[model samples]
Target: MTTETTPKPQHPPLEPATEGQVLSGAEILVQSLMRAGVDVAFGYPGGAIMDTFHFLNRSPIEFILSRHEQGATHMADGYARVTGKAGVVIVTSGPGATNTITGIATANMDSVPLVVITGQVPTTMVGNDAFQEADVVGITRPISKHNYLINDVRDVARVVREAFHIATTGRPGPVVIDFPKDVQQAQTAFHWPESVDIRGYRPDRLEKKISPSHPMVQKAAKAIMRAKRPVLYVGGGAVIAGASEEVTALARRCQIPVTTTLTGLGAFPEDDPLSLQMLGMHGTEYANYAVDQCDTIIAVGARFDDRVTGKIAEFMPQCECVIHIDIDPSSISKNIQVDIPITGDAKACLAALLELVEPTERSEWAEQVLAWKKHHPLREEFGDDEIHPQRVISAIDEIAGPDKITVTDVGQHQMWACHFITHLRPRSWLSSGGLGTMGYGLPAAIGAKVAAPDRAVWCISGDGGIQMNMQEMTTAALNEIAVKVAVLNNQYLGMVRQWQQLFYGRNYSYTCLRRRSICEKVCRDPGSGKCQAYLPNIVAMAEACGWQAQRVERRAGIRDAIQWAEETPGPVLLEFSVHREDNVWPMIPAGQGVKKMMRGMELI
Candidate 1:
């Protein structure tokens, strides 16, 4: 069959009318967003931002009115993570702006692209601490990739364009634009820049080709060829750069095993034999062992974060050579020294390495990794009686399918989801990876569903974490976003309690969400009859919000619960009554080395 596939035609970037009637700064701002191709934005309205909101009401851009600013930011983050586009957010001054800090930090940590616009007080009241005023640029300086406080109404179009450009470019992260109230009211001619030229802001520098003959690429290839055991450790950068195919090609071609960070989930298919689901704290035991044993480590788009490198000295002690590849030059050897540092896009560097490196059989190394995998497989069985959190996640994975997008809030459930769900596609797994923000799941799922309305979205949250932004349930219900929320109700702050149990001799200290003050510090088992009743019935709350809801306590009912949520007409909340005191295993205690991993009552 000799059939030619036509290439998809590319459309030119949308441009605003050059001689269009003069418009208010708010109108120009909306037009700027339209020009940048922003179809949806998550935000809240307040005095400073009222003008923009008024204009937004008439615009085609879909505005999602999140219950909280933090939730709105996460929604934008989730959208960006799934669509690879800069998610947009707009909020008013002071408290509204500060509320988004957590979300901004979360997005920054994960390298998710977001353009956050905050309405500011008038320029005259800049330092006067006017009503609802804030120094948003100052507050977000450290967290955002870049931030701006608009001084002139004419700068609106240019600033908006730059914000989007900065957000989506190399080493993507959130960019903040503070639009003053007076500027929004001021009149200006809207002239969207055809191209932005920011001096010293040359993200394009990272787009350069790394030829196969480049010395660094050649050196990386040689290092790979020389090592008998090489491990490909990837991170979120791989997902952001769309370098999954290149990463997999390099791993398979070189016969190297692959392990990814939590943010890097789905960068390489987890079902593959060479795939070591995740590495570092709460990572697979086999994966950690492989990293410890490998002679060569090729770190792609992964900065050696503290979570990933428990104790740097003890991490990869056997590794004699390191090849680091990332778009950000500073990220290379920032944490761990690298023998070969290639500063360029992940895909480009991997492609270059693929060309120079000759494929060789490393059967012995592969066998050793497989042996480790066999010896210490992930604990998936918790008997058939009670429902385990892992089983809940597994059931969801089965029902939702690999193609579905899964979002998670921070806690035991998040780790369990990472451990169990086999994410087959990049960006399908969304979580507050860097910041570990609680209450991010529901809103993020809303954003993900909004971004890809056709794809099924599942949100996995824990009892405590879900409560942080549970109010967003109304937002989801009102929008008719069919996001299936699985609350793993363990009746305790699982992660904190686990730490307390392991380190503080089970003091339990305030970790019990259900405990009353009169209860003992070391409370009785939640399953025991002595324990108090679980409060604020989650199922009842969901139903109150006009959502289809269910509560499941038995393992036999997991599938049916998940299926019900999937088939429900609108947003559904499934509360899985998980076992209390259950902990995420294969955990490296904080400040300890990866080698000192605790797995189900045994330290490896």
Candidate 2:
């Protein structure tokens, strides 16, 4: 499905400011958001943005006051990732705007749609280092999909519309609009444009695209016909384009196996026999082996990143030709050279391929892939005395069932969730995949809950990553959002500590959370000394934030705790005391190849 028919309900436009009537620029800005069909916004107010915040007092659009500007933007990002509408964020100047850069870049890197509105000093004082003023447009230019500095009040509607258009169209990404204080204070007549028209941007063609009967698509078909081992490498674009049905249909018709990237987790059904699950760094053993052995690989809406494609030359050595389909023309073949590149929407390109592609017998290839999967299953040694994080993830997956969403923070736990949990639908697995931003899970899960209140939203975060935005616990509690948060507390920054143990020798250094001043300065292998006390007491902090908190020390109680959280009315925090030294497996070290993937301490 395209954005035109995407399932995310576009909020109906609220009553706009009366036509041909004069209003303050701040009021006009608020009216513009209403007219643009923005039912919700996430932000924090400050000196520079007081006017807009003041006008928001009477607007019908709902606003979420975040604890920080970065958290606000991340909320918007999560809102956008699941809902088809562009997420909206409003923040004050200087530090507020700078804080949004991380969230904006996170969305940009993942191609998630968001429109960030930041307050700026008066146009006359743009470069004078005015109080709370920063070059927001300049700082965000390289990271954002597009950015604008509104100098005049009259340009507000046009710019906001264009920002949404650029953000939600082909190859979606975050767009920033720097609103000046003076412009917000200026009076102007409000008018909402019926459509957006921007030169040099023609993403409309993607929607207008017909089922590709072109030579390029036909060539891709021929490649599929010729290959005995063909794999469908799906990505976030497949999710963004709502092309799961098309991708699934195409894969099934040809009986080809599917392998996805982290961001592309739910693009194809993981339970399907054809699925190789994830296929890169921290990917499954069979998936990596499949890619290494396949003769043809078809990438949909996926950029062949270094994370997905390890040391390009060694990525798909057995693959004869590459077929890549994406909406962004520049992304096609920009990273990995494409033999048959189709630059269009994933749904459209794929729908067309289904018409021409012929079904062939791949039972032998499929059987081989299944044999590899059976041989190298994703499993962890769980001691009866210690909690296994993988079992916790699997428990959540089983208890939550299929009608839920799973979000994760970046860590060993994130990879564990990917390995153990199963997601059968798009927008169900939300994570900071491209940017790998920590502290994203909590606020993002809150935003996702706000978007789909009926579904159970589970947020899994590391002890370290959760603290980065744990302040949002108040945002969730005050709003009474039923988002279940699971903090896998291992007492150390697990991923980094693993790296320190692996490549940097056994120097634990400052990675230990329970380290005392009396401990060794470098804290060599401090993880060995298991401490009963976890610093900062996440349960106490969460309960203080008006949430139901439970701490589970035994692996046997994981399900009961999660069930208790699900039954609880408001936000719940379940902190599981897990093994500190567990590391993510099947990792391909940076600048290495798939051939160098390590399953444990040694290369497979």
Candidate 3:
């Protein structure tokens, strides 16, 4: 027995080598990020984050110096969105972090995984109202899945690991990590954790809380199986869950016609035989009509936003039953009551539904939808205006082609882009869909380009909205991102003007923003809530930022400029001087149902 024990192999020395040195907190942070497989970051440099950015600059990761912190976060968001990885954003304290709040909230609302790292005031200055100090943790608490404020340098590695894990797992959303200025400067014997251990932060990667046999899922599955005319409505969640393949599979298997919400644009091929145009406020008439006619509505990872449902009580009146499949339980029956509710991750739920659904032909339903599409094809109301917003967008579509990521700012141009552009690929269209943020497009486009460097990115923005975050045009030039800026310069907040035209008898309060100051500077009253005196020559601004800039006043030139911009290697700006009175027609009146949809050149 003693012989069998055998001499234990000579143990190697566990002591540290005499020449070993402790790593700095900044080094530890970057090393941990490297361990997590992070290859890129987007941010603007600031005083608070000097040390961290210094270390990051010396590291292997590629850092994009954005024109604004918000743009940085959004670029990170777009990157995360396209790659199915967590987006990383590093910003300084106070206004820097605050600027990124919109991006964080956007990710949160869209359920996109993002990790925002911000530098705080020094540890010694805690609670002293120090310079550039903002309570980032408190500001982002409700918007983020969770947030952490680092107090010690040793916790940097653990916090980052936990932050990344929390961001990427489960119902993915943004997470914030605020590190004090002193923490980044401090040195420590940093040991990156092999794994993270967080209690009460479990993400359900397996089937646990919900099941296939569960009452809700069973009811939903049965309703879907029995429905004669069923329409599948999808949302951003499908894309976030990486369920695009499954969604396409399920739709094709059942031969069901598919339509999407604005956020759902890239989830399915708009050019598919079974695809209907996106539905809702700015959605196509055909899509709305299909919703009105469908006997049953199958909502997958979609919330019945007012924009989509119109008046909820009056929406889809012909539908006798509803089946809702969503990860968030609250969304199950919050608006239109659900006949069957299946609560699970969209990707998982769709996979299960695919397995349960017997492949059957919905040829009749598909034929009806096709008929609707033929009857209500999307068309430009404006006639032969080469510089018209719609025409410009159509040309951009032609030049950029599909599969390129397109972002839009909030205004008439946004709606026009949504209406005119045909999205035939998943995660190709990114916009401030829910928030409708004005300064969203330029920065978002810059971010999107950074995220998908291989894909051409276009920023479809209004003259008014593009200037909001137009400072980031420099970012595009600096990074050589080659993002094409197609400015739909209607010189007004287009959508609001449409509402005014329809609801207020064309009073046109404060929407007009044109100014030449030839006779007198016709600046809209700044405090009148109509417009402001901040309008600038965006072409000149773009040129100043090292981008090739051209203004398209002629209709024919719109397409030419678009083609040239898309083909050019570096950043280019194509401005379309559009008509102000133009409106996106086939207008569905407020408080009206889909049945009451206004179609094709109707005199209101």
Candidate No. with top lDDT: 1
Off by over 4 Å in 3: 1-21, 205-218, 384-386, 515-535
Worst 10 residues of 1 by lDDT: 11-20
Whose lDDT is higher: candidate 1's or candidate 2's?
A: 1
Give the alpha carbon lDDT tens digit for every residue of 1-604 in model 1.
8888897865443345454559999989988898899999999999999989877877778999999999999999999999999999999999999999999999998899999999999999999989988789999999999999999998999999999999999899999999889999999777878899999888777667587988999999999999999999999999999999999998898899999999999999998999988988999998899999989999998999988899988989999999999999989888899999998889888888889988889999999999999999999876558889998898899889978999999989999999999967898999988889998899999999999999999999998988999889999999988899999999888999888888987777788888887787766453465777888799999888888899998888999989988887899999999888788988998878865788876542
* Residues 312-431, model 2: lDDT tens digits: 888889899899998888888898888998889888888899999877888899899999999998876654667878878888999988989998899889999999888799999889
Residue 130 Cα positional deviation in candidate 2, in Å, after optimal superposition = 1.0
Cα lDDT tens digits, model 3, 1-604, are: 3456667866342232121247666666777777778889888778888877767876667888887888788788778877778989988999999999998998887777898999899989978899999989999999998999998888988999998888987778899999888888898876767777887865574336565666666676777788888888998877777788988998898887888988888788877888886888768877888888888888887898888998888888889988887877777789889887777788877777776778877777778888878877777755554456788788888778876788888877877777788888777888777776788788778767777888888888887788777778888887788888888877777888778767876666666664334423433342243443445878888999999999888876776787788778899998787876677756677777876676643654
Alpha-carbon TM-score of each model against the true structure: 0.95, 0.96, 0.90
Give the lowest summed-lDDT range of ten residues in model 3: 11-20
Alpha-carbon RMSD, each predicted model: 7.8, 6.9, 8.7
Off by over 4 Å in 1: 1-20, 520-528, 602-604
Instruction: Rank by lDDT, highest first.
Output: 1, 2, 3
Residue 436 alpha-carbon offset, candidate 1, angstroms: 0.8
Task: Give lDDT for model 1.
Answer: 0.90
Q: What is the lDDT of candidate 3?
A: 0.79
